[model samples]
Target: MQTKDHKVLVANRGEIAIRIVQACRKLGLAFTCVYTAEDAASGHVRIARELGGDKSLYRVSSYHDANELMAVADDAGATAVHPGYGFFAEDYRFARRVSQRDRKLIFIGPSWRVIRELGDKINTKRLARSLGVPTVPGSDRPIYDEMEAEKVAQSLFEFQEQQGIRKPLVLVKASAGGGGMGIEEVYDIDLFRSVYRRIRNYALRQFKDEGVLIEQRIRDFNHLEVQVVSDRSGRNPVHFGTRNCSIQSTGLQKRIEIAPGFDPSSIEYGFDAAQVLRDITQHSLAMARKVGYDNVGTWEWIVTRDGRPFLMEVNTRIQVENGVSATIARVRGQKGVDIIAEQIRIGLGEPLGYGQEDITFEGVGIEYRLIAEDPDNRFTPWVGRVDGFGWPERPWLAMHTHVPSDDPYDIPTEFDPNLALAIIWGKDLAEARERGVEFLDTLVLEGANNAGEPLRSNVRFLRDNTGRILKF
Candidate 1:
């Protein structure tokens, strides 16, 4: 199918929405964008008006309202919907509605069946184990009965003991919950029952499903992700590469992401870094093929200090850090690979037109998630008006932000306090680290809240972490 025949409704906000608009334009496809009153001052709104004209922009009540989004898509005459990374991006019900509604707009992610199948942590674990993929040692299915849950916890403790783990820990989490909610860690098996009951109650109240999963809590591991892309066929799935997302905040939210996952050339590891990267990618592709995964998704994995990798969960949408991987990727010796554009093209029924062998990687890419927060004070969100925000432009650097430099922008309190995303590329790890520091050192970000206090950011934290990008 030709991409020009389709029009995309960008059902998202901030930097991702901006990128989706650019991606649609890049493919010669018409695009429309949505914004709420709180987000009217965002750069996405400005770019949509400047590039797509007033007719291409719509005012929506909420990003979470499926009905509002559908109405906007219909009003804009959009043939497809692009849920960029958050909100309805991974909602299977929303995806189903887009395909099953009377208008029948295309969902620009995985099929609803794929999302439904992989969204469940237990189901994903079972699928991985069925295909010989390594997963965290514990129950592959949800344990409802208290006796069975305790047994699983005991086994995990014993398993860790057998592996010479001095302090064994077990993780009890809600099967239907995500984003670090409905989870607890038990250091002693004797206290497992109480924690289990608490989480079960919370799960039942919040998710309406008390089914809980028990797994061994692996600590001191590097969080890695494999980027997979495929067309509607799902028969020719390929991987972009891996990214290291270990540098995170206190809440386990990722802050810095580096492409290629590891750097065996610059840092020595206890295990073969190259072999670990290859193994994880191979396993990720195998599972994608098994589930007939189509479109863009992320396979998250946790690698131990000894090089053992365990499959975590699948993010069945384009990720926030996808740009870092794209920065280092080359498809058929071509530069400037845009994964979002490829996702749109493939979602609209276009064939992949390329294979795994045709893809290549070069250089080191690092992405810093600039946020208006106090990194020293528990990473507290800083809500204030940004008086000044500017950074020196460089050939190897790319910035994606919603904060306009020409005007003082007030940070929205209703959403995450993320300011921008700065992606830097270099020939090697050393060069990338140097460039990252340079970018942060020269950044000019100033703001003040209603209380008349100065703004606080994570600039120092990001700069300090840049020197240890790929170290495990």
Candidate 2:
């Protein structure tokens, strides 16, 4: 199939939408984009108009409405749909609708079956265990009975004690819940039942499922992720590398991400950092190959202080931090690696064309998620108008944002206040940290809310965490 013959409907907004449109352009594929009324001033809409004319953009009531998206795709003659990161990116039902619709359109992530299979935490844990992959010490399946749940919780506490963990903790969470909902920490096993009951009740009411998962809560661990890519064949999959996402907000939301996971070249570690990266990547690939994973996805892992790594979950779509990994990756000894373009190509039924040995890593890369939030105050979202947003142009720096610099843009409260993503590359960790600090210090992002207060951003927060990057 000719790439030029296909058109993609960008079913998302903000920086990801802009990147997808850019990827489509790079791949010689036509594309259309959607925007809400609040997002009319977004840079994505402007880019679509400049590159694709009036027919390339459509207005929707909400990003969550699948019917509206389908209508827009049909009206715009889109042959495929690209759900960038959030929203419908991992939704199996949405993917199924796109594939099984009367006028079928391609779902540009993975097949619905693959998403459904891997989307479930229980199923993923079972599959990983079957493949001898390490997972958190907990129940592999949802525990519906209170006795079973308590037993699992007790075993987890005992297991932590046996491991010589100080102040051991257990986590009770709704198996069907995500995004930090229906979860509670039990520092004392005596209070476990109450917390468990509360979470179960909440889950039953909110998610309509009372099943709960009990696991040993591992604290002070370095959060790492393995980036994997494959074609539709699913027989051959290759990993880009690992990324360290330990720098995060109090809410556990990642603020900065560094590629290559750990850098023994610049930073010292208590464990074998290189071997740990290898273990996680090999385990991730093993599971992907077992399940025939067919597109770009991320395997989230938590590495304990003593070098123990456990699989957390899998993100079956392109993530916000993908560019950081790409920044340090080289395919066939060439730079300029674009993971989004690769995902689109494979999603369109094209072969991967390259093997794992063909890909290599270069230098350290850091990605700072610049957001309009007050990091000092629990990362509260600041609603305001961005009057000025600009940064210096450096050969080693790449910035991705939907906030336009030429005009004043309002910070929409309907979604996340992410302003831009600054990705920087250096010869090593020292240079990368220096350049990261410089970029944050010189960045010009000025704005004010409706009350006339000055713009408050996480720039200071990002700068303070520069010294702590990849330090596990």
Candidate 3:
């Protein structure tokens, strides 16, 4: 049973909010959703209303309106707040402020301290080393100016010499940035200087942090991430296997998302990717025990051609790929969403409805982000109305759209107004890939700006790079 006061205000928009609201309803708790003035009629809002939510909804100007969102949470009698992935997911200050209110404002992931410590690229590398996690070799501290960056670059070169490593490429990253932004791979000194200047400007504009971090880049790398869930006791944290994120730059802002990319035949019967996944999961859970990790998070890593895994960063929240992961689990008679709801219920001192083992992984899933952006136009944000959207018969697919049906968004006559997504699951990876492509083709986006070509490019990019694993 939930506690007497179990109201939850999801401080996010789009499919993320819808997913969380569903969890809230399953727990018999009052659920509230907030939206932007533009997205007031979004699918998230519609789902909340259909699920018996009230008009006490709050509206913000944009996704970054942190203060306004908090006010809405407060006004909605929300005892806990869940900030879904993206937006303020990694904002330590926002988490701290929400907790300061002491109204049981659950950040729903790692503690504010963990976010504050790991959100910085330099500090993250240091933490990885302390945890005995293999990390890319680079500067041990942040490089603030051009002179400092050059000095660090030289030292990195010297270190590579001592280690007998060749062609030591470096990645310049912002101290406070994620989402594949504010990061550039530099192959040489001149390139480092050029990319550093450009990346610094972008980082400054986005995060106001000019401090850059440099790290040796691994070649022929596969981006793999382990999802982790921990409790407040911090005694037992668990890893949820791994996902192959090697589908680099599938256009339209989709950086690459293909999970369980390993061939089943190659994986030994019992001791294969599943074993490594179990170990990683155990390690993550143990780390949470030491640091008091809460809710669900992910550990990102880069697997080099030689099979060495280097820890990259930790995401302390439900990821965009959560729906995909859950869809796959459901096919195997597992309930991933129920597991999440149970986690929240346990945290709130309510009776846990299910155990961890109840949600087991099965099959393969693909999550493709469909946005209304013009890839030819530098992936610029396209805003307007979604005139129409439908899906062909596909049992293993789930669609999440932010647009309202009847009250179509008014497209600006220059861009597609549909920022939606299609998550596909299959008994295995091959079938999932085929269905994903078909789903993208069947996506009938009607708008003034021709977003079809860019979308096609994204689908083709994924289809072409399916078997060839390489870094972006």
Q: What's the lDDT for residue 418 in model 2?
A: 92
Off by over 4 Å in 2: 139-155, 172-184, 189-214
Clash count per candidate = 0, 0, 6
Give RMSD to native, each candidate: 2.4, 2.5, 4.2
Cα lDDT listed for each candidate: 0.92, 0.92, 0.65
lDDT of 1 by residue, 1-472 (tens): 4679888999999999999999999999988999999999999999999999435999999998999999988988999999998789989999999999999999999999999999877799899999999887778777789999999999889999998988989989887776556778899989999999999999999768998999988889999999999999999999999999999987678999999899998899999999999999999999999999999999999999889999988999999999999999999989899999999999999999999999999999999999998889978889999999999999999999989998999998778899999999999999999999999999999989999999999999999998888998
lDDT of 1: 0.92
Question: Which residue pairs overlap in candidate 1's backbone?
Answer: none
Clashing pairs in 3: 234-289, 237-285, 239-281, 385-409, 385-410, 385-411
Model 2 lowest lDDT segment of ten: 175-184
Specify the poorest-scoring 10-residue window by lDDT in model 1.
175-184
Candidate 3: segments with Cα more than 4 A from true spot:
1-4, 48-52, 102-104, 120-124, 139-142, 158-167, 250-256, 264-279, 330-343, 346-359, 373-386, 405-407, 410-418, 450-457, 466-472
Encode model 2's per-residue lDDT on 1-472: one tens digit a residue. Answer: 5767889999999999999999999999889999999999999999999998436999999998999999999999999999998789999999999999999999999899999999887899899999988887788777899888888888888888998888999888898776555678899978999999999999999778998988877899999999999999999999999999999886678899999899998788999999999999999999999999999999999999999999999999999999999999999999999999999999999999999999999999999999999999988889999999888899999999999998999988788799999999998999999999999999999988889999999999999999889987
**RMSD from true fold, candidate 1:** 2.4
